[model samples]
Target: MRETRTMRPRAAPNRLIAAAGLLTATMTTVATAQLLPGVPASPREKGPDELARMSLLPERVGIPVGGSAWVLVRLAIEPKWHVYWRNPGDSGVPVELKWTLPAGISAGEIRWPRPEVFRTPYEITYGYADEVGLLVELKASEEIGTGARSASIRGDWMICKEMCLIGGADRTFEIEVSGAVEADATDSDRVPITDSEAFAAIARWQAQVPVAPPEKMKLRQMVEFPNGFRADANENAGVLRLSGPAGRFSEVRFLPDATPGTTYPEGGPVEGRVASGRFEVEVPISVRPGDALGEALRAAGIVCLGNARTDPAFEIEVPIGPPTAGGSTAP
Candidate 1:
């Protein structure tokens, strides 16, 4: 886990700042004109109308009755601008969605894609540039009758390049429900996406989503001290060491989940060393004094290896116990 501290907005470039100012001024003028006694206000626009293109897409085959499907909130960002992850790291805001579903329909949590680390002189943030697809699972109640169902989502997000701007869209999706209820849909059950294009797109993003760390990759052994934790005798703050098959990884880093009272260092690299198919590095995990430390501190985070596109990222949830007298190794 990284250290947690509040970050103030950094000043953007003069040209971009000026551009943003002008845009705001223009919008203000338009609003003022609409308020005038006899002036007619322009009709409101629907969908994304900003630096990013947004859409809500369903599988081409549409929704199935009494079964669940994936609905993607897709964002194709304009060049040079980016949007944030569920936890925006040190700065920026995460995407927000408000769903309007039919009485018998429900939506699941937003499945986030792995985020890239972006850095500026002022602050470091975690987000996606270019394009990203956030997936949500939609399930219809068993009693729901077959017919057409409408679902809508109102989304708000902040996009940033040299400066930041808020953007939003109102999008609705229509799906035709058919087929009888399945006897059981276990957690392991999955509906094979049939739309070639849509399936390909989803598969690309889904690969970026981290899964549980394989047993061989977990921090199964650790050395702790009175001051902090480390893989060796070195007294480094929030550091963990691991020796593994280095050949499998070109690089290794950790992207921690948002944990209160903890913060990570700015930028992408999680400091460590790899050599001759063996690796060892100290991972910094900071804990604030006086903050309630439970019986065991569980540090859950994503362990990413190799580059973003090629290799897969793994999730690890490890419990760090308090150091005993003379220090000891964590499980």
Candidate 2:
């Protein structure tokens, strides 16, 4: 309850490093939008249904190893207007967030919710449609209480439609040491084992994230898969089945799917084109436990792409498990 707080980490590392690593593939989208004359712009091609705004929420409040205070970054949108996740799908660019803070304060990484597919005959995209808040977790420096700590944020985002529209703002936000509130610390039983109070308070953020791709995968070889990839939707499981080699996993996770409840920033349906030996599948699964996703599907369900093996070229081929009575993985 009374942890020590320290200075915040510089956002440059995340901007130059983490952010760069996540958005490399997006370069193609920028290059595709050749600023030429008479491109036959379709309805402002980049015109948006609504404007997007960003703010912070106390709901994700937390105190880390240090006495630092943390909060959530909330991105609100007008109806039907969506934004891209860190890893944007095939045809769109990602929304980039840059935070500016004082010496003692620091910010956490942006958690990406799984994405809905945005399909076009040519390209598919991954992003959110309508109202959703992207949780920007933060930490206040321990020194803030002793002295003073503050921070500012500069975010850049490109909201897209049929064509891409780039929009960014250098907005000023603050986080200084404040007096303790009246909330009571959780008792022994109710308290979480490992910062559950912090996690539970923030876990609500999970609500807005996209459904994660399957963690368990058995698919064709890398050399044989197609660039466009293959997809099969299993509404019964509320999951999209992607067919691709281990390396192709990254693309699938970023691209959009056609699930009903899901939404994508780029307009249109996903393009399906897989190489002869390689195929990629995208399935939608409820990240939370005990959902309505069919039982049979759940038994053999592959839920998320773990950090260790989430790369586009990543691969995992389990030796065909010992043959079962039916010679198949139970479904």
Candidate 3:
């Protein structure tokens, strides 16, 4: 099978100027949505707006000064239609977020939930189905006064099923800022008094966020390519041996994110399997010549156990040291 990568389009210079003006002026709520050309909506499928509904939900009733408040960018996707994840695997663009925040307030990166794997004969992708909530923490400066602040966010995504449709929505929110949080208050006490359902939804998605592997389940090293990794080596193929308790998981898979100047071979022997008390995955690494390497020397991906949505997943970064002397390939 051939691997294909999909990327989001860039705006022209004129469009960039117009967008900058729009962002600086006022963020108008775009009620309607637009579909990308060529890929028409199927008769059985819903329209762009109907396919995905974007809304904002706050974790607390008021933002605490000198502290951060969590707000969820909830996407209620129609059944059978899905939105891409941070990696988006072999194809598709991940959902993008653009925020217009009040002065003295800043937005944090979206904490992505675990993504489901979607595979077909042509390509493999990772994304979400049904409802998915993305948590974005908004931080306020200590000098900011207590009052109500207005903020707006826009979400752009590519929802696909039998056909793909690019769509976006704008959501406006009024955030209430208060004094510093009390030192005696417990974690639960800081939760939103209102929006019980929203808080629960955020908590649910927060639980799905991938975390580091436990101490007992840490990766030891690569077994097959012990001579060290060479980005310029011929047919750079090896096995990533993860030492962990096995037999508990029936399936194992690796969903790779984008790494500049490097690529992972897809399909064929390039897959993962569980054996003994370890999870071993065959990784075929290829890289461009004379590449300026820094973080690119390390391989990063999500190691999924059993079912991606329901089972436990761990985020791993394997260091690829320099090749053996003379920059030779592993025998």
Candidate 4:
């Protein structure tokens, strides 16, 4: 595997135009923050946990015998405040989770919901405002004893508005261990699920999590070095082309996962508007040579449909190959 990389799409029109759009967004956010009552005037004006609260919501009352269940780490943020996403973009700390579980029970990675793009005068960040649900699946071993068990979790995050504050909370709960039940088992024989509202809420957030793009939507990537591989300056750039069902979407955008050694520069071309069911965007990449290149210079990120953060989003990882000798450019 190669170092983590930053993937940001140079917005449409041009750099100046994109900057103007971003500036407008920044201003709007600032204005919204100002309008919110009780917002901190300075970064250190309030207590660390004053802006955000955390809770855990398990989907089922029990981890089914030899099966798994999902639990959500929910964040409730104050007005105009937000918590970072996995790739926090220019600056911000993402939410971190630590779980203490009984033996034979393991937790899976967090299933992040599609994030909202936030722009400041100097940088861009991805995060969720108001509230968000991050799903973590817990699996129980088939040979484990059947009884009740205690599970605990701690969530740490940096909540932000005009400024930022680090916050954390710990929660513990009980889970029943039920024996395997037959397929035809009556409702009483099976472990019950959480309340309907809670169950539906979890499902709604699950739908926001990015997954593999469907086969029908063709997605592709390619790299081009305008200065012919300037390792010294870290000047590497590329393009992405995607196809979708006719009229199914009006626009597309890409948000790269954080890679250790890669940087996405500003002032790159923008090409994400859908034209005749095709979407394309130029992603500015800066790769430090002697680090890694070739097939290892891969890009992984979320492909969001529509401008709204809650809209449908898909995940993609594409190899970075040199531009074909006579490679065709997106029209």
Candidate 5:
């Protein structure tokens, strides 16, 4: 089976610009829905006349073998509203990404730009309050020997604001494998993205919540949850249970290992590095109810295909998480 994960390689900051341009290509709402056949209509999300509708784009993009590819998502947002980053800080949704690939092709994890801090008298949050694009790296399958051919990628994601709404759909874009290219990414094809624009935008957002220089003890680490988490699992549903040395580090937040806030911010912002170590918390499971237990263990929060796959290497990603494997079958 193809690698079902955010497999795109990480790029240097300058390449970050190119990836942002290419991936941002699909950020805003595209009038034409990149929907799969038979998928029901997603209620139209409102946007200002000046704001062209955009869709939620995935940073985990793909390319054809022997050719270059960029993956993205488009978020069609309403006027004066925005979505959350991985570190949503107290409240806000995270953009979860999943990719479908053919043999020999590969994709990268989402490369998030810096996010702004939304502070009200009452609470502090992290995210993009307006439309923006996510960027990723996709390389073609060298195995597809030089020739005229095509490769396809499917992306699924969610877009939300103050009120939460989950939109699940698959959109596939094709790439040509011929020595001569037949199509070039442009505003007409989807949307045009520029490196400068992305940098400026991110820089501006960063200004809103710039962290001070790191302490001498700066560090970074991830504490993964056990496999059996759930909405109402053994301990407070799917919330991660923390203990031991981190017991007193009670203040908890979920942010990406790199970019602090865009992808999974559930607490406050911590620079890409931390110090004086000990951390712990109970994290939530984004997996829906009635999902197969094994598959649930797989996709719950991070949408990696590994989240769906177990040791047997059996294939079982059924759009939404699958039902229990080899258990009493549901009629």
Candidate 6:
């Protein structure tokens, strides 16, 4: 067994935002020290028994001018060790990426695959074990000059089993951007690019990305208080009712978005119950004192179902209204 040591300055809370009526959360890990660009850290500094390995992988073929391509920041973890998800449930930090791109080039958000639930003696967390791929989309400006180009990425993550260790790496790779061929009178010119095994691996992980809930599922909001507004609003709690096709899900669990001072009930499970060929689960929400519930609270999370590795996980964002006289409102 590999020995691990505790690290200082725990992971920071995730930030939440509601844009265009859509609830989205950005996961970030605080860095104790930022490494300068182009400087690669020696992996040996962390010893050979490190829990995870990091690398950058680009598509096999060159990119076309004014076109976009995908790059993967791959993390291969040792057995029994795991890294965190965008929302690292009870504890843990999400992987952070810092990029050094050439002029006229940009990187998009990291597209995370659905993560597994990991329970510890003290708390439950969301993370991935074995291997995980973090995909990043790279785009080139239309005015980009055709030639050879390169970019560097710095990745930082926390790996843990019983103890935690912080690890990071800097990887730089070259990008080949080819000039666009002139189009013929009848057909549009298309860039020729061959797919590699790496591309196939990315495809597999992309399928695991959570998608919006299907039409059959209906989401609603409910509020509960001991004595309405007369009682302490801090005692007030929110609930989300998700009713969907029961047969499709043998079991379901909800992982709430990570926000400071906002949390789900400790040790409480959000398991789905089946009745009349439909499944329903109520997710509880608790807000700490001085934390505003806002006029419209958007509850964002993943709805995971079943035990099979291929089981489906749907992404859901339910907008909850303020406390009403009836203690509930339609979603």
Candidate No. with top lDDT: 3
Model 3 residue runs over 4 Å out of place are: 1-45, 59-61, 189-194, 216-227, 230-239, 268-271, 275-278, 289-296, 319-331
lDDT of 5 by residue, 1-331 (tens): 2341113222233443455445433222223234344645466733222232433232323233345544444444455555666556565556555655555556676655445556665566655655545555555654653322233333333333443444433444433332212233242222222244433443443333323213442222222333542334433122222222222233333333222111223444322211344543333333334443443232112111111111011111112222234321121
Clashes of each: 11, 49, 0, 3, 45, 0
Lowest summed lDDT across 10 adjacent residues in model 1 is found at: 25-34
Model 5: per-residue Cα lDDT at residue 264: 29
Best by TM-score: 3
For each candidate in turn, give its C-alpha RMSD to the true structure in angstroms. Answer: 14.7, 15.8, 12.2, 14.8, 14.3, 14.4
How well does candidate 3 score on lDDT at residue 327? 38
Better of 5 and 6 by TM-score: 6
Models sorted by lDDT, best on top: 3, 4, 6, 1, 2, 5
In terms of lDDT, model 1 sits at 0.60
lDDT of 2 by residue, 1-331 (tens): 4322113321221222332233221111111123236666565444232255655543212232233443555555555556775546565666667777666566777766554555657865557665445565565543445222334555556665554555554445333243332234333211112233334544665554543334564543211111221223222223334464434323233233222223333443323334554455442232222232332112121222322222232222211112244323222
lDDT of 6 by residue, 310-331 (tens): 5777776655445566765445
- Candidate 6 residue spans exceeding 4 A from truth: 1-49, 59-62, 179-195, 214-235, 288-297, 320-331
Residue 263 displacement in candidate 6 (angstroms): 2.1
Query: CA lDDT of 167 in candidate 5?
Result: 41
- Report how far off residue 330 is in candidate 6 (Å): 5.5
Report every candidate's CA lDDT: 0.60, 0.40, 0.66, 0.64, 0.37, 0.62
Candidates 2 and 4: which is better by TM-score? 4
TM-score of 4: 0.73
